[model samples]
Target chain A: MNAIEVKDVSVYYGNLCAIRDVNLNVKEKEFLGIIGPNGAGKSTLLKVILGLIKPVSGEVRIFGKDLKETNKILGYIPQTSGFDRNFPINVLDVVLMGRLKNRLSLFHRYAKEDMEIVTDLLDKLGLSDVRDRQIGQLSGGQLQRVLIARALAIEPKIILLDEPTASIDANSRSQIYSLLKELNEEMTIVVVTHDLAAVSAYFDSIACLNKELHYHGDKELDEETVEKIYGCPVELIAHGVPHRVFKVHEEGYDD
Target chain B: MIEAFLQYVFLQRAVYSAVLASIVCGIIGTIIIEKKLVMMSGGIAHTSFGGIGMGFFLKIEPIIGALIFSVLTAIGITTVRRRTNTNSDTLIGIFWAMGMALGILFIAFTPGYPPDISSYLFGDILTVTELDLKIMIALTGLVIFVIVALFNYWKAYLFDEEFSSVIGIKTIFLEYFLFVLIALAIVALIRVVGIILVIALLTIPPAIAKLFTFDLKKMILYAIFLGIVFSFLGLWISYQFNIASGASIILLAGLTYIAAVIIKRS
Candidate 1:
């Protein structure tokens, strides 16, 4: 069964339309990369899938249930740049927030098992040494990993990330993508980003979106398809990443 | 002053009530600062004045009236903040002025030998009665029970409201529940530190605690201890100089906040 299905969806902000008549089907364990330019409704589409924003039309089903009913099956990692990193919280405390189901009562203690799970995630993510450290004290890469640990703590069947590597350095970006690749083995993963090179190399399937679902399912990003999706003859953004670089012939020409 | 407590029932009541007020301030204050709702809290604190006026007009206990008015205004502000696209500052400002105006109007309309609410306005901690002490303690106990019982929810809600809502936390209701707690805490503090000065006690201790620790639970415990120390120090200072205890206490808290800021900066 498909992990997520979006049918005939559209969204608006006041008078401005964002996504229109968007339809998609994401099979389980698929690493789906959604690529679009800024203001192309990439993030908005992710929000729609996560039930954070309701599409003005159409239906969203996750694992054969309504999105709202199946929301618990999805974990989300929003952009790291969107928060105040100086907030007074330790890594363990932040991750524990994802364990909402285990919170039996106000007076109920976090069980030994819960702590064990947190420690295990911390260790697996190579963050065990800094579990007690303040969030503000961490590097961009470390902070991204902490947010991933929090998202994974819920054991969701699918994880959605919106611009996870937007502000990080090059090393952190590759590490984050590699981590996403590894996590794709355990759960379906959907990422919304503008990094075409990483999308070509790591994502199992690519969805080229620009206000509408231009290409809902494919991994073969030929030069023509890339040019069509971006509405321009794209520049080579490979930056030494293992991607099929675009060969420029004449001006605005694709070989 | 310590000797005075031994002989005067009112002084003893005032001291006990001050402690109770501090407990509520410390506990709820931590959540307030963490949630970044200090300004919203100020609005509610000032809005309680309308209730105080109502109490005087109806010949009822002022604290009881303050509690009702403050909780309603909290709910009202939450509505306006959510449903309307109006700026938050504008909404708060309107309620703040409306509350004070209604309070003054009610006081003016009260029959001859009107209720003496000068202490409630400027805060005279020494005027606390046994009834006020009982009310403050009971309110503090309730606030502790709610906050502790829903500690997990508070953590989740405070950290990220959108994420909390997505995680099946009934975030909207929790938001209202928290606002009501803020309202209750404000009313409990009205006698110890007048409405004008209550926000200081609600915010200063937690702000100081944040300087030392990043953990919410630790911040609360630290703030509670600071609240007690500052209250007593202010009480002692007022006794020595024959000044206003409420103003003295708020003044001490404010000064300590400045000190903490300077120390951290250096």
Candidate 2:
């Protein structure tokens, strides 16, 4: 059974059509990458899938249940840019938010099982040392990892990420990708990204999105498909994996 | 000094009401400051003036009027801020000025404008009655109960509204619940600190408390403690100097905030 099914979904913000006629399906344990430009509605699609925003038309079903009805099953790691670093909250408290649904009482202490899971997850992410630190004091990479740990706290069946590596250093970026690769083996993962070079090696399948679904398939694409989706021609590069580089065809193009 | 403390029932009532109001302000104020709604609190306080004016004009209880008007204004502000892309601050400012204007005009039109209007303007803490003390205690209990009962939901609500809604916690309901709570707190505090100085009580203690702690829960507790201390000290100073209790309390809170900022910088 498909883990997520988006059937001809359309979303709008006032008069602007953020995304339209979008259709996609994800199988269990598949790693899917969504690639698009700045205004390409990639984040909007992720938000709709996660039930953060309502679609203007069409339906989204997760594991044969409607999107609204299955909120508890879906875990989301939002883009790090949206959060205020100055927010005064501890890492443990933020992670504890994931367990809010299962809490029976206000005074319900964190059980041994809950602590065990949190400790194991933090240890795996190499963030056990900073468990007591305020979320505001962490580096961007550390904060991103903490957000991932929060999402993982739910032990969700599917994890949806939006630009998980946009602001981190190169070494941390690779570490995050490796962590995501490990997570993808356990659950279905959908990531929306603009960093094509960084994420290309990790994604099993690519969904090139604009206002609509330009392409969605498993086989690695040639230069032509990448150029078509990006609105430019692919140039040859020597060192990187057979990647696509768009040439400056327009007058105002930079670099 | 000891004789002065117990000389009058009014003075004793003032002490009780001040302590209760300070605790409520400290806890709820931390949430307000964290949420960056200081101006919203100010707006609520000013709009409550209109309610107080209506009560005086109609010979009804001003607290009831303040509760109704402040809650309605809170709901209006919340809805307008969410639904329309209009500048919420502009709407708040407009209502703030309008409410004050309506209040002054209504009081002037009333048959017998009591000289106690000055007491509501700049709070007469020395004149606090037993009824005022009862209201303050009841409101404090209600605030504590609501915070405890909705502790889990409030954690989500305080973190991120969209994220909380994604987790099925009903963002709209939480927003209304918060506004209602704020309105009730503002109304209860109207008599102790008055409308002009209520925002200071609602924001300063919490802002000062944030400098010392990273934990939200601990920050709230510390803020409450500091609020009570400042309120008592401010009341004593006001009594000794024959100054306005409302202004004195706000000045004390401001001084505490400044001290916290300096210590943090050092």
Candidate 3:
């Protein structure tokens, strides 16, 4: 069964088209990486899947159901920049937010069992010691781990991350990627990232997107796809513009 | 001061209500600062002036009018914010001015001479009647009840609206509920600090407490303690010097905030 299916989807930010005619289908537990440059609708595609933004055309389905209907089975880790750094929220409270999906959430308190689950997930993520610490006190890597632990607290079947390691250090990026690689063993993983190297190394299926899907399949990034996505024929443009400008000035001076 | 509480009914009411307002301030203030909604609260407080004027013109208690007007403007701001591209600062500034203008117009049209409306702008905490105390107690209870009932959701919503909503939280409902609660908290503080100083009372204690602790519950506790102390000291100072009660309270809170900054730096 496919974990996520996007059919003929297009999105626009009012008048400007962001993503156009994109199609994707991920088999259950498939590791998918989407790569694109800035302003390339990479994050927009993920937001469409997360139901944060409705596509201007077409549909997104999760676990063969509408995205909203199957939301409880999905987990999300937004970029750490989404949070208020000054909130006095402790790690445990932040993690426990994942349990909000429980049916009998008595007075919005985390049940003892829910706490146990959070503790176990934190331990697995190597964040057990900082469970009581304030979330703001965490390093980039640690905060990302806490966010991942919170996502796991939902016991989701699929997890979506947007630039999970964007602001973190290189060592932390490796740690987070490895952790994600391990989690991919059981759950469907979809990540939107700008790191082309990570896509080449880790993703079973890589989709190169620049307003539209330039390449999609179980293949590493190729030179052509990279050029198509970035649209930077830099050497050709550099040779043309500077040479032409210099020639024009040289002739004018000689005259 | 202790004997004064036992000596006068008005004093007893002021003390009781001040404690309640401080607790509400502590709780709501922490959320406000963390959410970066301090300016929004100021917008709401200033707009409540329209409600006060409406009450006088309508021959009703000014607070009732303030409550209705403030909640509506708050909801209006939230709605316009959600739908339009207008910067929130501009939206809030418009409402802040409109509210004051409306208040002034209504007061000008009120028949015969009226009570000084500056009482709403610069509060007289010593004038808190027994009835005002009862209403404040009820409002405090309401604030506590809502916060306790929605603690986890509030945390999730405040932390990340996107993450919380994707997990099936009703974030829109929570935001509106919070706005209403903020309005009620503002109303409670009106009598204690008046509209002008209510934002200070709602913010300073939490700011001071946040510097000391990162735990939300602990922050609230420290804020409540600080708020109560500031209110008491302000009340004492005002009684001794016969100055404006609200100004004195806010001034004390302001001084403490400076001390906290100095302490942290040193």
Candidate 4:
């Protein structure tokens, strides 16, 4: 069974259609990248799959189970920009929230095993040094890593990330990409981003979306295909590597 | 001093009730402040005025009426907040005025309204009864117990609502639970501090405690300690000056908050 099955889904906010008639199926352990311009409903699609937003129409199924019924099995890393960086909480405490479901009762103590799991996840994320530091004190990149660590603490079957590297520096962005790539080896990963250039090289498959599904396939997309998806001509500019730039056909202006 | 302490059982009851109420208020106040629901507490306290009026009309226990009205309003506020796109604070303000107006109408209709509306307006700690003491103890115990039991849930609730929901923490349930707890605390406090001054107690102590600590747990403890100290000092000042005890207590807490703000700014 497909790990995530979204069939003919449309989402609307009031009269404005966020996403229209999008259908896609993600197989197990697949690294799927969702790319589009701003307001293209990329995050909306992820939220719909995560069951945070109800689609105006169509159904989403995870592991053959309905989306609404599979919340516990899904780990979501929402856009970091939406979070309050000054929120007063510690790193370990933030991660331990992921284990709340497994606790027997409200009063139940955190088991040694639970602590060990949290500690291990922090170490893996290279955040063990700031385990006791308040979340407010962390830098943007550190905060993003902490959020990822929180998602990992759930031991989810699939992970959904929305703009994980939007505001971080290049070095941190690459590190996050490498970490996500490694995680994809063991879990189904779905990333929603507008950073098409760097992402095309990292993602196994690309789902180009703009309110509707422009393209959905696993093969490496060439410049013409990306330009078609973006409605412009494409240029391969070197930003360390040859990065594809979607150029406007009329003015030859890179977008 | 010994004679003054023993001369009035009512004064003794006031001290006992204030200590218990302060403790409960201190802990719950921290949550309310952190959750950014200080205005909601004010709304709940004002809404309880309708309950107070109802109790006066029926010649029944006003605290029961206060609890019912406050909890129902809490539920209503929570429901409206979830189902609609309207700003919650606006809804709360509208209800606050409506409740106050209803309370006045009810009191006017009642024959021979109690001359001691001041107690409901500004708490008369000296007039606390044995039943009031029992109720305070029970409610305080229950509030503390729930807070301790739901430590992880409360922590998650405070940290991030969306993240907590994504991780399957039952965000709605926890939020409603908090609303109910706050409603209970408001009801219990109505008799000790009166509705007018109750919001002060709920906000000031926690705001003052915030200045001293960054840790949430430590902040709550400090708030509780400060709440108790302010309660006693306010009660003493009220006695000495023959003023309203509840208002005096709130004034003390408010001053402390102001002082803390100044200190932090400097």
Tens digit of lDDT per residue, candidate 1, span A42-61?
98998888888888999889
Candidate 3 C-alpha lDDT tens digits along B43-120: 999999999999999999998899899899889999999898788899999999999999999999999997688778
Compared with the true structure, what per-residue lDDT tens digits does model 4 show for residues A1-255? 899999999999879999999999999999999987678899999988877788889999999998657756888787777765555568888888887773327586777988999999999999999999988788778888998998988889899998998888888888899999999889999999867656656888889888898888853665566666666545432223343332222334365
lDDT of 2 by residue, A1-255 (tens): 999999999999889999999999988888988987789899999999987778999889999898756757778898877766667787877776776663335544667787888888889888888988998899989999998988898889999889998889989989999999998879999999876665457788889888898888763665557667667634422124333322222323233
Backbone clashes in model 1, listed as residue pairs:
A106-B149
Fnat of candidate 2:
0.37
| DockQ scores of all models, one per candidate | 0.49, 0.45, 0.53, 0.50
**How close is chain B to the truth by TM-score, in each candidate?**
0.96, 0.95, 0.98, 0.96
Model 3 is docked with a DockQ of 0.53
Order of models, best lDDT first: 3, 1, 4, 2
The lDDT of each candidate is: 0.85, 0.81, 0.86, 0.83
Please report how far candidate 3 places residue B59 from its true position, in Å.
Answer: 0.7
- Give every collision pair in model 2: none
* Alpha-carbon RMSD to native, per candidate: 2.5, 3.1, 5.7, 2.9
Q: At residue B129, give the lDDT of candidate 1.
A: 79
Off by over 4 Å in 3: A102-106, A234-255
After superposing candidate 2 on the true structure, give the runs of residues whose Cα lies further than 4 Å from its correct spot.
A102-109, A232-255
Sequence-dependent TM-score of model 1: 0.94
Better of 1 and 2 by TM-score: 1
Q: Give candidate 2's error at residue B252 in angstroms.
A: 2.1
- Kindly report the docking quality category of candidate 4: medium
Error of 3 at A138 (Å): 2.0
